[model samples]
Target chain A: MSDHHKETFISKYVFSLDHKMIAKQFLITGMFMGIIGMLMSIMFRLQLSNPGESFAVLEWFLGSKWAPGGILDPNMYLSLVTMHGTILVFWVLTAGLTGTFANFLIPLQIGARDMASGFMNMLSYWFFFAATIILLCSLFVETGPASAGWTIYPPLSALPQAIPGSGLGQDLWLVSIALFIVSSLLGGLNYIVTILNLRTKGMSMSRLPLTMWAILITAILGVLSFPVLLAAALLLIFDRSFGTSFYLSDIIIGGEALHHTGGSPVLFEHLFWFLGHPEVYIILLPSLGIVSEVMSVNTRKPIFGYKAMVGAMLAIAFLSFIVWGHHMFITGMDPFLGSVFTFTTLLIAIPSAVKVFNYLATLWKGSIRFTPAMLFTIGFVSTFITGGLTGLILGDSALDINVHDTYFVVGHFHIVMGLSAIYGMFSGVYHWFPKMYGRMMNKKLGYLHFWVTFIAAYGVFFPMHFLGLAGLPRRYYTNSAFPMFDNLTDINSIITFFAIVGGLVQLVFVFNFFYSIFKGTKASENPWESNTLEWTTPVERIHGNWPGEIPTVHRWPYDYSKPGADKDFVMQTEPLKEGKTEH
Target chain B: MSTSKNNTSKQLLWIAMAGIFMFFAGLTSAVIVRSAEHGWDSIDMPIWFWYSTAAIILSSLLLIIAKWQVKKGNSPSIYVLGALALGLFFGYCQVKGWDQLTAMGMYFVGEGSNPSSSFLYVITFAHLVHVIGGLVALIITSVKSLQSKYTKDNYLGIELVSIYWHFLDVLWVYLFVFLLYSVK
Candidate 1:
């Protein structure tokens, strides 16, 4: 494992087994997917904001069949919305957030040479790469991509003749998803094995950083829950391709009755949400973990209530499984079952509250540095609280009956899980760029990116709650379909305007990220003056992580401003003095 | 140090097995719930399935013997080949069983079928797929054992394949019992 090997281009960049290179691949691919997803949202927002108005920009991107005479076809509108949700949820948030950070940080923070099985790690990325290609290929098919929404509920998804997009497009979507599941399982297993077995000497489970704990739990959740989604996908595949009635039921289309019978669509919902609810936590916990580390470093204090934070995360993971029924409360589930779900869903708030309070406690009365990472961490806390409070209303079976499938549900999830997670990701990129690339992002550009994104995010979603309250249903191509909804047209326009602005602001980050990698200020080994083991590595990336033997951990990662310490932060590799006790 | 690494790899295999178990648990639960609904008509179990079940059980017994023989510092290829042959035969019998069902007009899809028989076809087909994966592993281990790659003190590959083969054998038994009681 020497650093002086004559590495070729393919082994170094294209198909390397190094965790750092693989992590960069995930980040860049995720960013590419995020751009596509964001552009789709902006396209649909234009159609929503101005119902019948034709824009040449739409014609340029979508071409004649979809946006003839510049007006978006109604079916294509649904297609954009569906692909947007699917790509962002699965490809961007799930893969991008977890894949990028987990692969990057797991070995560095845990003091491992590499993943326990590097070959499997390489296989995982290729699976994800193939899945991405297959999914993108679906867009070029004659009928368009899977348009039954990101959930791809059956009857619509199972019966090809039901919608034009249900033909080859949906088949490709299922194949892509099945491939993605395989990739995730492979990656998740590798993370678990590496964390469980490959920690450096003295890095016990308790001494492990919060980021490692979050990733470990996230991997466990993925291993258990993703298989259920695979089963759901397989059954849907059987119904669609093999003509089995696993999810299809008695239906009449085009004056003909379908052969499918005795099967329940509710069953598909049951299976999908079983993976779907934990998926929210899966998307959020990594950011939550990153925010904890960033907040401690920037505030010059130890993370408040570290044990309680870990306990809260574990509690949230356990509670995520039982609370999925809340998503189906309005679908005529058993009222008793709904009540049980509502209780479990609301009980999650206790752990969530503990985490938020601990974050605020860490920031209180401390000498806080307002780095871009810290600002984004604060933004995450804000959106997490705001979005989370709305869940209480939606979780109540009685209240959810009114807001189900409305803009209110959309607003709640986007703000809490969507924006909060994205902010956490931004915080991580800004904080860890130095470690990853040995360069610093421009702070002024970082500040500009943060404020605009923060303000515009709230500007876009905050008003959607009122529209939901006004009884406007989601997935409507035009609010003009109902005269009663005509009054809220102005609000839709405002939301769309802010969404476009927010979407454009992301380009600043894109520019900053690429520009900083090549030309930004050079960073020292410990630029953030953090206590974590990752910063202890030299600025240059290496194969086995260290030129010599890996460093041993003598204390926990979050030892900021400890009493009797010479400096404000003590590196985890520092040895304990004769008289001082380890924090 | 090498022994600890071997243990960790084995532990990873078990964790993966648990995940596979949850997958089947989900599908089986769906079958029971789907069966309870209206318009559900039950079909008779094909006799070939019973033979396939016995073949898989014997395959598991052969693998156990192979494991025992290897640990005793003896050549285990005879038992390994015996298990692999039975495993392939079990797969052939499963295809024959499906063909028999189709002959008897119990379709997995289309007008002649009920959801109950469809569940039978699906659950069995999924298990057969995993069994195929086990067969591939068995074949590789058989080659390694013939080359004397494994020793009495280091038979991790043999042990992993045997453990996985037996798990598949046990899984098929559970699915068979479930289908027997539930599929009329």
Candidate 2:
């Protein structure tokens, strides 16, 4: 509105106030980091499966320090694993997933002109970019990236000489994390304020889409939890730089006694897990919400229980905070308290069960249209169920003692957080690709990508469950080192085979992504005959979303197959009478 | 919606402020709990901290008076200068308190002594760091007032800055009293 039309390149892309442009920036950045994180995993998997084997490409990539004569060094292996976890969790999953979708959808779906504070929104993206730069710079440091692990456990992280990565790498890791926390806080504040204050005339809280609900609650979780991580990181920085003992004690760095005393690493574990476990849910809930919207529209039916779905999301979020102790059950905590944590963790299954059943019920006996987005939604539900069943096993204290650091834990999270959330991301991209690009993605190519990814994801992670059950520990660089793991060698190799295929299948997505951007078939305004308000906007991207006036919400987002509606699905802006509004 | 944007923006600003307050709140909790633990040794605190608390409280009153003077077109520079002096005095008081602890032979990460003294130092130092940020904001407001950038009709910046300043003023007093009365 204020002479934004003739902006320069830097103002247009780098520091754009346009929400869609901001979303595009986040998407591209996230994809770049995702490629990095995924490639790191593949490299590690090669080491895990082959065990001491290397290629010329490996040497060319690593140089002499990490791969001497094409052989993988142990410290480099650990550092790569650490960096993989760091990039995927912070930059890719949290920032990429929430950052991209929240920027695009918050203003559009809520029918506002833009976010509540445009300056803050732009600041959030720039802070995230700065954090990404700091993290990448730390990799070029002489000591390598943080190798104390992504959690950066103390005693090792507290004392400088405990490991090579703890020297400069750990310091850089904390700095990156601190910057990232600031970025998330800024974005979270904007999201919450916009949702609370800037909804259009008739968009009641209950009438909002599931995506808005997830974003709002997820922002709340970010607001309350990220600051705690900031506090922990600050204390850790003090321990590292300023000589505080908040989480350091009984230490000997280079065989010299540390000046620290009476500090408990368990306290650090408590603080870290306080943010850590809820962070897992924070990364997944957006995907789950996206799946709901996609599924309802694709199935040509209303979501089975709209109020119940919102309730489940809220319940999951609240339970997420109180159950952070699940991650600390094996960290020398009281066994009695483990029972309490296990109880709360298992109680989460109730709301999760409600969501699962609601999805199934909505898909029951409906004229289901299996679009690219629909395929991803179904993939999410399947993987969520498979991953969730294992969570029950891990949540039990007696069982957890055996599987705490086993490959079983890896399998559980990859299926849930890794595969399921990735599916959610893909579903969103496919669903909104038309709205975003004014074009349609190739349906045949999308189906191919989905099936290969879905089958291969399960093929890759499911065998790790059997390996964990066979008493194999995780984070071991080589499986052949222990004769006890010899039988599991075949299983690990099989998983790698699937993983390589799955990783390669992503190339199809890469091709589709670039090809569709410029050459895909042009689409109509509402390409997918869905009932959400986003489809009602123009096909081409507009500066502030709608053409002139914002739309007024009249019903809940899912209004498919109503008794007297003209079409199978009805737009949210279509006014309905009082008694007819009940689902 | 336009009608309530101001209120909502203020609410959001408070939410951000609440995050900052809760961060410090967690630190205070850690300090209190650590002192109650075994092996904590108490250190001698300065008398100047109590005097600084009183100074900050007086500054809060002066800040309120300046807010009133904005509408009345009254001479508020004296109160503004008074609040700045008190805030500086508070910072100087903290530095002197650190010296007092040093003179008493307490050290951060000290060898073979109670760690409670170190906790005291860290708590005070962390709070002082944040207080310095608040002081800088107040200083900017003072500069803008001197240049006549604010008036009764458009003093939202002054109002918000003073509100934050007063919040920090009361926060420091509470921490001072809590530390003196109950710490160690």
Candidate closest to the true structure, highest TM-score: 1
lDDT of 2 by residue, B38-121 (tens): 666665468877777888888889889988988676645667777888889988988888777777787666563344665677
Q: What is the C-alpha RMSD of each candidate to the true structure, in Å?
A: 1.4, 2.6
Docking class of 1: medium
Instruction: Kindly provide the TM-score obtained by chain B of candidate 1 when compared with the true chain B.
Output: 0.97
Cα shift from native, residue A310, model 1 (Å): 1.4
Relative to the unseen true structure, what is the C-alpha lDDT of residue A513 in candidate 2, on a scale of 0 to 100? Answer: 81
> Which numbered prediction scores highest in DockQ against the true structure?
1
Which DockQ-derived CAPRI band holds candidate 2? acceptable
Model 1 ranges with Cα > 4 A deviation: A1-4
User: Who wins the lDDT comparison?
Assistant: 1
| Chain A vs. native, model 2, TM-score | 0.97
